[model samples]
Target: MTQGFSPTSTRRGTLAGIAAGAATLAMPRIARAQSEIIRIGFPTPLTGPFAAEAKDQVKSAELAVKQINDKGGVAGRKVELLVRDDKLNAGEAATRTLELIEKDKVHAIVGALSSAVQLAVNEVTRARGVIYVSISQSDTINEVKDFSRFTFHEALNPHMTTAAVAKHTFKKGSKIAYLVADYAYGHEMLRGFKRAQEALGATSVGEILHPFGAADYSTFMPRLRSMRPDILCICNFGRDQANAIKQAVDFGMNRQARIVVPVLLHNQRLAIGPEAFDGVVGGANYYWGLEDTIPSAKAFNDAFKAAHDGAYPTDYGAYGYTGVYSLLLAMQKAGGTETDKVIAALEELKYDVAKGPQHYRKCDHQSVQSVLVLESKKKGEMKNPADLFKVLATEPASEDILRTCKELGFPA
Candidate 1:
């Protein structure tokens, strides 16, 4: 399991108090006067393996709501966020999602870090016509045809990340081995990378699946080392990802092989440190250093740094911030909280986020946005620790990838 955020006990308690107090004060009014307030549900893993990411999401969501409310939130209504912790489990996520939709009566929901949780929650939200904005990378969330009435996604899917990594990081005929988590999201990432690798004329040497939250990776490292593939693709997140990379380094695998991570985040960089990350290639939805390329990105980075004492924005934070803002935009565009209208607006979205201009491709509802292919540079090559990555190439939007989703029985 990923480690939970280690905020001081007092601080954690205080934040919980604030959230509870705010919810208590806001819910009654929201229920009585629907036009006066818009309630948004945030169902995320706030206490489990992915807790660090969830903590960041909470902060980002709070910041977004505060900003929106300060500006006289959507359609002259104040925005209220109701948060639930899913413990990063699929069943738990589904239960919490029902509570938020049926009990709390949220107009929309934004969260669930893992694709598995998102998929489970989608089952509930879609059936009831509640708008859901997924931040996870699993392609299945947006590909399901029956859920179009309520589901939309704002993050790049595994296929987008895998295709970018395959095109920019691998050499022709390169031998590859995969160390992936045994979960829906990890499996999707592996499938995407496998297709991309084969398309690039690369050979799949072998694969090892690690159960999520496996503490020690000693058993898996030796098999991967034995394969001696030119590249090792990782498809796990949070502490599991850090542990795998660290264990691989301890087993001297880094000295012999290059790593190709399908999803890399700033928190992972902090966990693994620069020495272990050097020369690694991976894909990210957004990186702070890319701020120079987009002006809105610079403003977001500056605001986040100021608020969090220079904390680097991770994929979780970006998703949380963008998800709330995106939903608000959709609500404004739709003129009200009508589920179908909000979802249609979201599907047709073409906005400039912290990353460049992004469009939610109508076919799969996947964000056709920039996915950064980064090489972890050494300290000597950096102007600062945060300058750890050098952009390689931005993969062009491919209709073929979207077509593949439809071919695989997903909604076109």
Candidate 2:
């Protein structure tokens, strides 16, 4: 999101004069006198249900910061990371973001895994003219009215991921049912899936929205079984996601209907386990196995595995790592910490990160990247326990997907 502002100079003349005189005197020693620190604020759910996911993000960010600083830092400035927990709440996210910007005075901020937290933090950061790069997978984060000059989304939106999965799993005339969480993220994911399904001439046979963190999906499962669609799309996250898939299996819906997950992260995959997810089709921005094809990705995966005892890095980790580095690259291009310049640089960016070719679309500030459509293979078919997927297809990029995003109230 981008924002506009009027430039103002409020420095008192005498103070300005003194400062200028001091700067003149210190010109030769400016490099030594100036603080070499560039602080980055990370606001995420360090506690609560999302703790495991958040921990991966924190680890990834820490690794990235360490790598950057080791490579002579960014333009001779040592990077400093300040982490704050949002506790998975938007209100707390906003409060913590303000603290980071005003009290901590961070140069830029990377944020929480939940879209709600990202949206809340973006609002606060935009209003205050601070740079915020979102690592969350919420399309709404990029739909701000004025396109806040400081905000950028480094993660792939639901539109891209959903469309990719739908295209891979749904054939013409395919019947589908959606079991979505009753929240902004779930709604957005459903919208993306519905759009893609409709474009392929598929029918949405049924739809159900349950509250987040709901324990029992028994009611929803029967509804799904009754519909008996060719495919059942699950657009929930964390425990809700795990429960929905598990119930689908327990209710025998899995035997009748193929399961499709619009956005399944690593933790959720582990939560549901392979037994429940076997033969499932899902979408992801990056998978650790893809690292072999790309050097940077290979390095990242190796380092991440080394640090975490071979645990696979999830979307949260990949996004957090790449998101922070991307923002740092933009800051470098902008030549300073100024918000507008940084946003402009971000919009113009195109780089091959771990996820493959990724560009921050100038029109909507949405990251354009290749999305993987993966099918869950049985445990026996796996080369290793972590190598559980078979690549189905790489979705073709189209302007139409992004064009539809505009109708969804996002900026063109």
Candidate 3:
């Protein structure tokens, strides 16, 4: 249960600035920002499919901001977070992003849970020249077609997730079937899976793209048996993922094919319960226990747990903390909140904010960090609620699994 990042192999150091490319609801834009305070916008789902994860995101973000303020604020200006709920609606997300800028005049943004919300907010943040660090993992956001200078991708995307577990997923057999969420993220996930399957000499049996908020997956279970898949990969997250796995178990599909999730969230695991995911194996970007391996991670977690009822951190929580923490660093380095100066500082910034050394590729505004493969142990084997999985492999960001900015078609 004490999963370390194998510091020797994964590499370690303080993470630094990532001028990455880059959330919310209807919270009224604060009419004024006091000269003594710096406001940062946090737009994310508070009442939607990703709500559980978003709560963790907000908690970590708030903690980071408070720490900054406690340490005499950034450049003598207190840090304040203005939050809004986007309801996981892209239109609402974009609107909130604009409000955070045009009205609240937030220096930057941190915390977006869904790819759709992240993408939509990115469009607005970029156009406004505001920095946005995303917590969602959709490779398309970094695609040259949609890449933005003002945005930094902080979360591991589908491509990165694939690098962590595709080989193991295909190890059992060649006939692969997938039930993906029908959206931009699902499309990117499918692309990553297809690429990996082809490279591993695996054949696709069949695939299904269900709606985002789908609750019933019983429809697919009856038909899935004919595919005779060696692996049934579920490319979804939050409630959609939990529901699909639950029904798949009900249909007795768990005994038929190995269930593989591209990237599993802490909240999703809790929602799916131990019974549904007792033997599930997948990848993750971060875990609270990893703080034990990385000093910076421990710094964040110690304070977070002490104040938040001893609850551990999730990857989303890590993203929220790092996103806000790094921005504060950039602002301090820049000595002001001007867009150009902050961006320059972020391009070279590093801090021990989380596990391993994280940095942003100046070319694409994508954070380079490690991706971890994990397998959930049986419930009886778990020593604590947080010890959901055993770390199987830790792939350093230096590996070729995550494409270089140039390879991703980012202009030099």
Ten-residue region with minimum lDDT total, candidate 2:
5-14
Local distance difference test scores for all models: 0.77, 0.77, 0.78
User: Would you list the rank order by lDDT, best first?
Assistant: 3, 2, 1
The C-alpha local distance difference test score for the whole of candidate 1 amounts to 0.77
Model 1 pairs whose backbones collide = 1-213, 2-49
Question: Deviation in angstroms for 15 in model 1?
Answer: 32
Cα lDDT tens digits for candidate 2, 1-412: 1224221223222322333343345323223223458889999999877787898889988888887788877767788889999999877887788778667778889978887678777766765667888888887666644355577778778888898888888899999999998988899899989888889999999999999879899987777888879999999877777788888888888888899998766777777778888888888877787876667778788878887898877777888888888887776777666666788888888776566667777767777777888887777887886877777876644455564556646545
lDDT of 1 by residue, 314-408 (tens): 66788888888888887888877876688788877767756767766676566667777888888788887677788887665445545366564
Winner on lDDT between 1 and 2 is: 2
Error of 3 at 269 (Å): 1.7
State the displacement of the C-alpha of residue 193, model 1, in Å, after optimal TM-score superposition: 0.9
Top of the candidates by lDDT: 3
**Weakest 10 consecutive residues of candidate 1 by summed lDDT:** 1-10
**TM-scores for all predictions:** 0.88, 0.88, 0.89
